[model samples]
Target: MEPKREFFPKVKKTVMPRPYFATEKDVLGHRGTAAAVDAAIYGSNWYLDKEQGLIEIYDAGAAISFFNLLPRKDKYEKEGLYLRLKIAYRTTENANVNLRNFSGNHVTLPNSLTGAMYDDPQTYWWVTDDLTLNINSIFSGEKLWIQRVDWEWMSKEIIYEDELFAKNTILYRSLEEVQKLYSEKELTDDDVKDFLRDKIKNDDWFAKKCLVMLREEQLMGEKLVKLFEDSGLEL
Candidate 1:
């Protein structure tokens, strides 16, 4: 006997109505999990575009972190400019964090002098729970825009070191410090440690790679902010 084909509804493009930010109250109303969201959304993809504007949610993070990390400059703060965030969404249980490129339409900045990314309504995600996610680039300027946010990310140093050293750590070498065994030859751990130390020290290329990783992490942070905003609560 042949099985019947299941019918599925066509996916539609979501439209964000009057409110752009989501508060914790919305989540309480909808009964959602913040942990799952933090893990899946912000912990994943985020980044910037080549055109000097933020791409998806992740891109927004990268841009903000980049701006924040740069030396204080006058023009970036004084210039009259605004950011347009293009948000896409889905309500299905199978829905994942997938922030696409900006729609090219920018959200106007609040009337004020010395604009900061974190100050813009478009860049912030406020939830009914009173939890707000602020996105800001550490640096400023159109020419230096392409530099990835991960380079300036503070947490990257520890996170990367932990992941890279996970298997070779002292804790994993046997909880007992079994080096007491006479049969064991010279420790091979020194070589691995030395190699990693040198890579972080002498190799300029390794430094660049670290920068990319930091920017990617920043991107993830932005996505989480977007998810909270899209949750449909007051921001």
Candidate 2:
């Protein structure tokens, strides 16, 4: 008798919708047992008020902390896996900190007391490696009270909206310059194609913009599409 083989495989992914908070004990207790800890000072500059649920930083120059994101290969492989940090408290006057990762990808936290999201263009973590995240204060006066850290997979609609905004910004700037140059003469189809060709050839970021223009059926959109297709450029 032959062994039975299943036609389909069942696979599920676990996602965390709410923010994950790490306490003082959690960090201090699991410091050496887990991955390597570069620097985590408790009393000198970094203080944790368990009562108020806040991690306070005072005049600490680049105070660092490590976080271990449990193995989640499926979640990491998905698109728009944005890392978010909930800033509970921050000084109103020039108080901010930089959230740096193991890969050196960092984003400046907003001065205001709000949640900061990391829009990293590069891959943050790998499937086989331990996901270690770090945080630091750049300036001496920069004080921050971090509440918790979390991550979420952004929806496709939100991603599309951001792309739309970028496309519109580029289109507006290009049109402003074109209008000034062709104020006296009527803008012809050839003029539009030439402008687009120059943008596509010179600007590296214009390829995305060209796709947006074609989707919106803007002027010379067809011609621009044809030009890219003829040149064997994948848009």
Candidate 3:
């Protein structure tokens, strides 16, 4: 039998009507289009600045990606929003396919945005890795967000199959990959101070990125902890 053609689920992008307090000029050219599309899907006007940070809209959240840790890292960056996602297909005749099979059981990738799946339904929760999300890639006023990753990337073969790999639950993105997306330049002096003073103080999510920014900026030791002081918290 001939192999079946691959199919992928898709979302659409279309020109949005002029948003209130927003114009093509307000959003950075191509980014305006992205924001418009995102707004159409998410039901809120969204945009990003030059440094890839969120300007915010009515309590909307930022878009963060642990890009380097994504399954097909090279593909995502090269293709922009175009993701060629593949599902773990198992046919009874072919049990040795790429992904392990779970015959007579139900297994679905519950929250995977990139479609990483497994055969066993019992292996539900994905363990985490050290790869942190690029917190500054958030956008709201001028640019649309790239996708964000709030969960961890795990490998069952490493943990369940053998003792060859470390018994850790997560995988980490390389330093170079982290810098490319969440560059030091993304966090400005004011942005850093603001994040350290407010966002980090209030939410634990922002803390890791804040520490990365502080180290990147060379705000070492006391200088680092001192920034936290004004936020009315300790590092």
Candidate 4:
């Protein structure tokens, strides 16, 4: 087996729209367009970021090669949407491709101006490494997302597949890949303190809540117990 290359951060550059879906006619006029794009797989309005050029939609058939994971069935009984996305990156002065299959299962699209329009289904659940692929080349990279239905919805429980692969490789998060791309910056005591402070300051609502919980527990003289509890958590 070839030595697996560690994933590097995906470099992003803003660009003008490629004019793929510039008009309603482009979506409705073309024959086989809906099927090609898998419109039925995800509702028409399920993808709301087209106006911002933040997303690009393509037919599922046009993206078969990018689907590194097992393909979901065609039927869906759930209420939410699903989709496949191609995320592109630029590194080494060359654009690289990445694949992500997004089954919009129980995912909500953010309507706020500052919020992202599309949410990855994998974010809520664990994803296997095989579902992610990095393609190095020119012509811009694309992160492909494939959305389809499955059998787990009837139970209302999230599906967790132990053996997951995208593009024939195990899926890894950007954080996991960061270690290989950047040399670890050994931190001094002062640096560690500074980093912790910065992280606490910039943390999101949920993160801040956790911090507050920790502080509250410590203030109640249960710091040692809390520490022990946290220490026992599975990675």
Name the best candidate (by TM-score).
Answer: 2
Rate residue 135 of model 3 by lDDT: 22
Query: What tens digits encode model 3's per-residue C-alpha lDDT throughout 128-221?
Result: 2321211222112222223322222222233465754756654555658645764546557998777668976898878888677778646554
- After the best TM-score superposition of candidate 2, give how far the Cα of residue 109 lies from its true spot, in angstroms: 1.6
Q: Could you tally the backbone clashes for each prediction?
A: 31, 0, 12, 25
**Which residue runs of candidate 4 sit more than 4 Å off their true CA positions?**
1-61, 66-186, 213-235
lDDT of 1 at 88: 19
Taking the tens digit of each residue's C-alpha lDDT, what string does model 4 give over 145-225? 223212122222333565344232322346555445456767799998887777777878757777788788556776667
| Model 4 whole-model lDDT (C-alpha atoms) | 0.34
Q: Which is the winner by TM-score between candidate 2 and candidate 4?
A: 2
What is candidate 1's lDDT per residue for 100-191, written digit by digit as tens?
Answer: 22221233222212222212232222111212222332212221112221111011112345576564322223524433442455658898
Which TM-score value belongs to model 4? 0.19
* Cα shift from native, residue 181, model 1 (Å): 25
lDDT of 2 at 67: 42
User: What's the CA error at residue 173 for candidate 2, in Å?
Assistant: 39
